[model samples]
Target chain A: MLDKTTRVNLLYDHYGALLTEKQRSFVELHYLEDLSLGEIAIQFGVSRQAVHDHLRRAVDQLEQYEAVLGLVSRHMRRRAVKRQLAEVIAGLPVDDDQQRRLLELVGELCEDGNGTGGGDGDV
Target chain B: MLDKTTRVNLLYDHYGALLTEKQRSFVELHYLEDLSLGEIAIQFGVSRQAVHDHLRRAVDQLEQYEAVLGLVSRHMRRRAVKRQLAEVIAGLPVDDDQQRRLLELVGELCEDGNGTGGGDGDV
Candidate 1:
């Protein structure tokens, strides 16, 4: 259950910006802010049920995008590959500085994953 | 327009499986099969307008998923990175076999992008 929440959080982290303003707000309040349905309803001037409905729809959209694109999963895999490459490089006769540079490149790849996801207008 | 079609084709390649059956069929017929609107409508036992509606909705859905997930764009960037790496590695003082191996690894990364997109159930 803990892992599920974390995974959902990561998905939201990657896709939240693409959601509608209302959906984005609802998701952030419920998930990140840890607000109860009634509390979120009060903040948004809606009923608790409406708050729930919005949050559900938003989460559904996020999940659908993930199902098709698997961006989050792809990033995770790239990180795994990088880690493996690091492990393999460790056994090589390369100097410490070269190994460190390769590892740093791997780290940058992970960070760049999120940034480029916004696509053409962004770059 | 040519570029747009290519871009949409790439999006469909990654996401066609996630679309509904009707949507997928319509997309395949109109885009890939290059059938006339009336031809597809007759084959599907529907009006041309209905076929248009399904295709429009499917394309909209695909575009939405891409906007959020950017899997196609990410793959494109990774390919670009691989190309750049190939160029860089070409100038390195490494043996020919080692350089070839690194370039081959980069090529595999591009190919692997589409495979893991199916995720856990796939692996």
Candidate 2:
């Protein structure tokens, strides 16, 4: 299982745009910027309670989106699968040109967490 | 670009759960079940305009979610990448056990669209 901060960061990457502007700001400030609740409250000119509420709601909303869509979970699974694939390729008896090329392809997909393939149009 | 029906179906797959019950029902009825708007409204005991409004809003919401998350887009790209990976493996000079195994792995990932990997736990 992923740690809370890492999980929230991954969730935010997948569903942050679905959040309200204030909620988005609060999460970015608190999580990404590593700001404390009091600091965020002071920065946003809101009470600490309000900031806390927004952060909690925003995180809850992110988790809710994950629960429904499962995009984040799928992404993690794909990454893991790609890693296993690379391991299998590496275990082949001979490390020839073909093996090297195949490993390169696996590396590309593994690095491309979103699977854009560097916009090569020939993935 | 995908056709309207295909695009809507893909979007619906990614974001259908985020929709309200009525919107979900209307979309499933119209798109998945091949029911007409008037038919849906009559079945639900609502006006045709109301059903149409719900469908329009629901599809719009799905598109909005895609715009933010891009899960559908990434999924298509990943599928394409897997296909290309398979082709590369097939074209290898030698047809050995390792080559066959690599192709099988690629085939597994390709078939598992949501990347669950058949619950094998090894993947």
Which segments of candidate 2 are over 4 A away from where they belong?
A93-97, A107-123, B93-97, B107-123
Q: What are the per-residue Cα lDDT tens digits for candidate 1 across A52-101?
A: 88888878876866775576776676666665656655665556676566
Tens digit of per-residue lDDT, candidate 2, span B1-123: 898888888877767777776777888899888899999988999999999899998898778666666667766876777777888777765558878878776654543243121221110
Candidate 1, superposed: residue stretches over 4 Å from native? A34-42, A45-57, A87-123, B1-4, B47-53, B95-123
Clashes of each: 0, 0
Cα lDDT tens digits for candidate 1, B34-105: 898899989989999998898888888778767755667766766666656556556555676765665554
Tell me the whole-model lDDT of each prediction, alpha carbons only: 0.65, 0.71
Model 2 CAPRI quality: acceptable
Collision pairs in model 2: none
Q: Who wins the lDDT comparison?
A: 2
